[model samples]
Target: MGLLVGLVLTVIGFFLSVLAFVLWIWMLIDCLKNEPSVGNDKIIWALVIIFLNGIGALIYYLVRRPERIKQTGQ
Candidate 1:
């Protein structure tokens, strides 16, 4: 019984990790698809989220996305 319970918990943990990865990928793709301009801060944040994982996603949401960056009038 204990062994079965341990296996079940391990499976659940694996699924949760996979879910988090999927969510991160989804967020990265969504951010990339947005026509938010090249060199925009949000894009950087998105890339950070994509490559850096959890902390980057948190920063993207809490710090970057809220303050939209404008293209430098080059």
Candidate 2:
């Protein structure tokens, strides 16, 4: 029972890690393509996503992305 529970937890952890990585990559690409390059917004957001990984991606998703989409009408 103990071994089975440990295995299940490990598998869950692995899948969650993969999901976080995918989210990070998706956010990075979204920033690169959609973020305006007028000033340093693109570069900054890209750096944030790269350096901060999952947390940064989540921040962007919850904050900037919606605002950007609303502003750009895309």
The numbered model that scores best in lDDT is 2
**Model 1 lDDT tens row, 7-50:** 99999999988887776776676566653666675567666997
Ten-residue region with minimum lDDT total, candidate 2: 65-74
**Poorest 10 consecutive residues by lDDT, candidate 1:** 65-74
Tens digits of per-residue lDDT for model 2 on 1-74?
99999999999999999999999999999999999888999899998988999999999989999999998964
Whole-model lDDT values for every prediction: 0.67, 0.93
TM-score of each: 0.64, 0.96
- 65: Cα error in model 1, Å: 5.7
lDDT (Cα) of model 1: 0.67
Question: How many backbone overlaps does candidate 2 show?
Answer: 0
